[model samples]
Target: MRRSFRVLLCLAATAVGLTTLSAPANAAAHNYVALGDSYSSGVGTGGTYSGGGCKRSTNAYPQLWANTHAPASFNFAACSGATTTDVLNSQLGSLTARTTLVTISIGGNDAGFVDVITTCTLGSDSTCVNRVEQGKTFARNTLPARLDNVYSAIRQRSPSARVVVLGYPRFYKVPGSCNVGLSDTKRSAINSGADVLAQVTAQRAAAAGFTFVDIRGAWTGHEICSGDWWLNSLTWPVEESYHPNKNGQARGYLPALNAVTG
Candidate 1:
């Protein structure tokens, strides 16, 4: 009777130990890495994230997704003021064979979208047009190759990872009523420039066989001139100006990403 009782105790202990080892509640399996510029880094969103000057946001889409889904590893490599070359040199290091998911929004800084916007907001109409034209020329002639390089690097790093490329939203609402911040001429020029940039970005993203989310479409009624704006207009912190606010990341960007990822 004593030997039988001892054997039963040992069996129960082994079963409990195995169950604990095998059934960890929070064990992660998927690896997700986010790479890009201020938009991806969440600079426009209030409150900063880790990673030095990258200015990543806890409220950014990548972090929001990871917060709920809880991937095995989440690397937020996107940085503020990051260009395609910056990404190639700095951000790609976070990727590896284990990376299963990646997201990026690049090329805007390469074309100097912010500078063009500044020119439009403060300078004369023709100045804005000329600046915008310059930006469009760069987008057409140079941005495609730069985008291709970034996409190629992403592919090489994470061959099987699902890469989602998101594009910038148009800044102004055409025929909008407010008429306060920028002139109609400037607004139209900016919008048309955005269209050109999106076209180039979408083309390169498609060529890479990656998913491209058009936040322009997602943010139609919520642009800078709309009554309920997702993007910030000219404001303090200067960098946050023209960038998406917290609501933009949560509602505009996050939902756009989710629709594709799901």
Candidate 2:
């Protein structure tokens, strides 16, 4: 009886040691890496980090999620004006085997979002509509393959990571009017561009086995023309125009990211 009791105690101690060893390994699996474009970088949201021209905001969704969840490690690699190629060339290095969570908002730049918005807002109505249609064409035709390459690279770099692809919110609230300078026709065109971006992004994300978070619905009543606008319109600093405001990051994006990642 005494020998049997001693053996049982030894086994229990060994089990406890094994559990202890595994705890940290499990925690380390929570390493997170954020990547993408101006939307992800929080360009128009007011704050900047490191001044490398990325304009990363403290209140961006990734940062907000990281602060709330307290992951084992967080790497913020999103940059303003980043296209699919930029992420492949510059940001993919941040991912590794241990990276378990990844979130990115991309493809807008590749679709010439900035250029489209600039042309639409400042040019003739016909010109604006034509530019927007061109953007949609790019999103449907060229953007997918570029996105596939980036997504594949990310998977290859961090095979274990759970990638979440976030899409843009529509800039204007439709069926309503505002004194924000954009004609109803121009607003419709720009919003159509946003829809195209979301659709293409969703398709690419699905193909890559990543979760695509569409912010359009969540941002429905809070678009640029709404009384409670989440997206900025033609701000003094031209760079600030068309991006999400700080409130948008906090209320709009943070909740969406949390829902998927949680």
Question: For each candidate, what is the lDDT?
Answer: 0.89, 0.89
Please list the residue runs of candidate 2 whose C-alpha ends up more than 4 Å from where it truly belongs after superposition: 1-29
Number of colliding residue pairs in model 2: 0
* Model 2 Cα lDDT, one tens digit per residue, 1-262: 9999999999999999999888643433489999999888887787556438877888788888888888899999999889999999999999999899999999999999989988987899999999999999999999999999999999999998999999999888776677877888999999999999899999999999999999999998999878799988988688888888888999999999988875
TM-score of each: 0.87, 0.90
Model 1 residue 112 distance off true place after TM-score fit, in angstroms: 0.9
TM-score of structure candidate 1: 0.87
What lDDT is obtained when candidate 1 is compared to the true structure? 0.89
Question: Model 2: how far is 207 from its true place, Å?
Answer: 0.7
Global local distance difference test of model 2: 0.89
Give the clashing residue pairs of candidate 1, or none. Answer: none
User: For all candidates, what are the clash counts?
Assistant: 0, 0
